[model samples]
Target: MHAKADQRIRVTLTLNGRERSGYAEPRTQLCDFLRHELGATGTHVGCEHGVCGACTVRVDGRASRSCLMLAVQAEGRRLDTVESLAGEEGLSDLQQAFRRHHALQCGFCTAGILMSCEEFLSRVADPSEALVRDMLSGHLCRCTGYTGMVQAVLEVARSRRLATGPDSQQENNDV
Candidate 1:
């Protein structure tokens, strides 16, 4: 016998460094599960087909489009949403840069863009302006015109490189 189409499955994953479990239909999108089941509303849903990049989240340390993934597919994986970026003290460096640069206007796309940038900065310690722009091309923001975002990302890159030095390991997400 096969599972019914409406059958719900228990999906367990490490979310924001904490183990989380929720029940959802196997066909439910990861974004929906995160928002409705886990109460992680920061992961937005836009252009569910995945072109808009508004549903971006970190899956096992890489930026992934949650809208493109099924909730069941995320079981047993480590996932990080925008809520994971900040600490008890304050916002992360990347978030501070965005705020200082006025990189967000309406803020609908900010969460996903921030998640993507967090993953990018972790891998590229000293990113150039062109590369930063390239990485941001995947996201879509109706406001802020992308200039402030580019500047913010570059500033964070410079800060991370200066803090860790060129030869040192890449910046950590907590920084």
Candidate 2:
């Protein structure tokens, strides 16, 4: 049996470091819920089949396709959208690196790529250019040609390694 399109459920989750709740039909995609109900418009919807990766968000500390997930599936999960990247101080290191390297142009594919790169950096503190490119294979960008994005990721990795020192690099890599 399929859930009625109008049957809305109260979905709750930790979004962008804050507790957020919204009503969504069982059939509603998470990206739609976040954008329409929760006002997380930063998680753009593109190629809803999950190929373009424009709708990526961090769910439980991993990059996930919001368009491919149901709203109910995000309940109790810690979700981080592109909106969470900037703080009062301004853009995050990764975001700053993106800006400096001109990693984005049209910006449609940037949010998803940023989310994926953020997760990548968290798991791999010191990554080679090949590895960064491999990780970027999941995303598609029509504007920047990926050279700038690749450079941004590498620059951020190097900066983070320097900021945290060599000892922390090993620990971060082990994660």
Candidate 3:
């Protein structure tokens, strides 16, 4: 009898603050690896061509398209999906802001939008409407006109500033 060979490659990475190790095909997309393998389904897979940005996630604090990246590429890196935004207490401030501003309609694009907004807000504490629009341009939301999404992010920014004061400004500047 012929011996079977292992075709999957070993991939190890930190996902949502937890170290995860798994075997995946070298060509497996990170989105599939996260959802199918690790079961992090919050990272939605929409266009798959990197145009829709619905598979957006944070890799080492930078926004990235999970569908456009391979699972092996995330080796030794820190990855954060939409699920990480919420803690044990409840939804995150950004999530709350999204709800308060009615950012989501059908909710198909909420995960990616939130991830992108989180990245943008981390960099610009108080971004202008135009900036917010530009930053979110990559994401496609068929439900809302994106005005609500922008407003939601802005609301979070305002709240951060009001609650943290100048420290928030300094933190945003540092990014």
lDDT per residue (tens digit) for residues 1-175 in model 3: 2222446877899999999988788778999999999988998899899999999999998899999998888989999999999999999999998888788988988898888888888888778999999999998998889888888888888888788787547344413
Give each model's clash number: 0, 0, 0
Error of 3 at 70 (Å): 0.4
lDDT of 3 at 170: 33
lDDT of 2: 0.90
Question: Which is superior by lDDT, 2 or 3?
Answer: 2
| Worst 10 contiguous positions by lDDT, candidate 2 | 166-175
Q: Model 1: runs farther than 4 Å from truth?
A: 171-175
Overall lDDT per candidate, in order of appearance: 0.91, 0.90, 0.87
Which sequence of candidate numbers ranks them by lDDT, best first? Answer: 1, 2, 3
Query: For residues 45-124, what per-residue lDDT tens digits would candidate 2 score against the true structure?
Result: 99999899999999988899999999989989999999999999999999999999899998999989999999999988
Give candidate 1's root-mean-square deviation (CA, Å).
2.4
Cα deviation at 159, candidate 1, in Å, is 0.6
lDDT string for model 1 (12-45, tens) is 9999999999998978999999999999999899
